[model samples]
Target chain A: MIEFRHVSKIYGKVKALDDVTFTVGAGSVTGFLGPNGAGKSTALRILVGLARPSSGSATVLGLPYAETACPGLRVGTLLDAGAQHPGRTGREVLTLGAMTLGLPRTRVGEVLDLVGLTERESRRTFGGYSLGMRQRLGIAHALLGAPEVLVLDEPANGLDPQGIRWMRRLLRDLAEAGCAVLLSSHLLHEVEQVADHIVMIGRGRVLAQGTADELSRGRGLEETFLELTAHTDRSPGATASPGAGAGRGSA
Target chain B: MTRAGHHLNDIAGAAPSPITKDEKMNADTPIPFRRLLAVEARKLVDTRSGKIIAVVMVALVVASVVARGAVVGPKLQTLVGTAGIALGTLLPVLGILTVTGEWAHRTALTTFVLEPRRHRVLAAKCLPPLLAAVALSLFAIVVAVPATAVVSEVRNMAANWEVQPLGLLGWTGGNVLVAAAGLALGALLLNAPAAIVINFSTPVLWAVVGRLGSAGAALAEWLDLNTTATPLMRGDMTWSEGARLAASVVFWIVIPMAAGLVRVLREEVT
Candidate 1:
């Protein structure tokens, strides 16, 4: 379980996360939803101990994330797909992460296979990897220790339809095994399909939180998402189109 | 209630909780520093760049020994001197490559995520190169031994090329210091090309300044990296000169290293 207790972050004069508070329960997939620059990434970083909150605290499994004895083993994260050494092969990158957690080196190959990158693991350099491939590799690295909690920021970014499907399934499996899976995405429909719970933020403040069906009411998930996060200054007038709404609900 | 039910209830109330001492021990045991360092070292060694740099250093040392022993006779000292110059130029470049490799590959995030204590990660990164520098220096001396003997036999002249163990140690120490300084600079710059350029150019610029006049020479002798490193490497300095050399290294290497470490710990990995 991950808990944010009055956590706040500021950059210069702008408040990146404004006294945010939430809980991600175990055995469930929690989707963090917000428009760009809405503190989604900042909140995720704080949860993973990459960034300290300006005020208050974040905890993973009742202990401070920063104070966790084995952060790599306890909480796996993929904050950004691009955050890897481009010169290293996929296998090498995963192995490095595994070693940090005192995990067996063989787990590197296992993750590669899990992410469906086993064939290209040795041959693909990070610099040459396509965006989708990089995302998959990043996910593989995050899964290195079989961490109890998984924190992913835009894990589906750069993935195609097939890759996205794989990702949804992967996240579900992880949550089913009692891992607290917290992922951020701009795609509400994807969240609606996969998330057991939803935490919505706008302009660095929570606007809504509940299950997908509970949050959307009887309206289409995307339409309801757009309506709930409709404040112009926060979202910049980007709303789900009718066709997108239909396609998403069917999917 | 039956006698058995009464006994079970009494047992349930009287029995201590099942929290074992082992569970408490597991919770209290923090991850060891050595384990984290070993993990960092493993990452450093596993990379292609790390392997290439090691291979290149060995190749350069062997080639220097063979070429000087086989081709150049009386100028063996000069060849050694040339090799020293080449190493001074190259070691810093390798150091920059080592430090910036994390950033260039976007692996800094992964590295720091694994070891959230950034300072520990930085220290681990420095350890491998420093050890390798000392080890390579010893290896170079050993290789030079056989090559020097072979040259003496071929030329029929007394092998006056004595290996100064202290000189080797000082030179190796100086190289490690410079390499660390380069690593720090790379961390601060966070770009491989820029860090390498600054590392190599700083000494060259000081040399140019030294050529201006007596005053410039004096200033250079006091402030210049080459002047400081030369005395330490060659064992040709008085006590006062050695102190000055030590001071110069501290100023150049220690200050930059501290600054780089600060930057690494404070700056967000983008």
Candidate 2:
């Protein structure tokens, strides 16, 4: 299980997340919805222990991630598709992940096959892959440890229809097998199709949370999402919260 | 597997094979520190840039030896010292890359996410290049062997087979020390270009600035790394000289490394 209990992340004077609390229970999928600067990425990064929430704890399986023993065994994260070194082969990337997770080396090929990357593609350097391929490799790394919780950010952003379908099945299967899966996405339709629960946030605060049917209220998810986020930020296009792009690089 | 869907009616639709117990979580063990070291070592030669650095390091060491052998007639001390200078400069670059490469390539997120304890990760990052530097030190001496022989045969130079173990240890130790300093610099800076720039420029800049007057000389005596390290090559420092060397290393390497560890632990990875 994954949880954020009264979490707030502040960068300088700006609050990226404000007292946000949510739970992603095992055997289910939770879709996190937010605007560009709404702190979806910030939340995911905190849950995975890449970024510490300034005022609260993000816990996995009841322990704060940093304090958890063998965190990789309980949590898998794909926060950045471009985070793998471009010069390393796809297999090497997964191998390093496997090594860190204390999994058997053979798990490398298993993940590559699970993600539908051919042998050649797996052997090729990551720099040669397209964005879609990188996303797939990122997913493969996330699955390397067979973690109990999967935290992914925009995982299907660059996938083809077939790849997306495969991802849907994989996520559903994992959740069915009692894994907790939380995803943050800009693809509203895909989130609608795959998420068992939905949490919508605006300006670092949760605006609404429930199932898609609950948030819909007879209007489609896209329309409702637009209406909810339309006036959330007063400045209209203020996407640069201090920590907005920090998930990719450090100061 | 009895799959769950959004609708209650879909729960009993069909079944597939379950994910086996072995495929479930392996939560009993965290990756060992030695394993982390091994993985970091593997990374040093895994990428194109790492390969280039390794190759370039070796080539430079050999070229330095060849230049000494061809010009100064391959005296063992001169040859080893030349290799030490060349390898000393390049090995630190490798060490810096070992830490900064993670941030430069944006791979720090994946790495830290997998192993969240930042200290263990940093410790692991320090091992590989230092180990390689030791190996490279031995390689340079070995290569100097053949060069010394060739020089004795052609240039009528006496082959100084009398080797001082303490001096050899000092040279190897000195090289490893510089590389660790590079690693600390990398961890402190986190940015590759910035870390590298500071790593190369700090000594040269201090060397120039440390020669202006008595005050500058005193500062250099206690704070200049290049001078403090000379006693290490000779392995014959007095207690006062040793204290001075310790002070310089603390100011340069230890402080940056401790600060960098904190920054790596606290800095947000986006």
lDDT of 2 by residue, A123-183 (tens): 8999899989999999888876667789999898889999889788778877877889999
Give me the displacement of residue A124 in model 2, in angstroms: 1.3
Model 2 agreement with the true structure over B11-65: per-residue lDDT tens digits: 2111111222453434656668987887888888999988898898999999999
State the local distance difference test value for candidate 1.
0.73
Question: Taking the candidates in order, what DockQ does each have?
Answer: 0.25, 0.44
Cα-based lDDT for every prediction: 0.73, 0.81
**Deviation (Å) of A50 in candidate 1:** 1.6
lDDT of 1 by residue, A143-216 (tens): 76666789999998899999999888777766765679999987777787889999988678887889988887
TM-score of 2: 0.92
Model 1 CA deviation exceeding 4 Å by range: A119-123, A232-251, B1-31, B74-81, B154-158, B208-218
Residue A116 in model 2: lDDT: 77
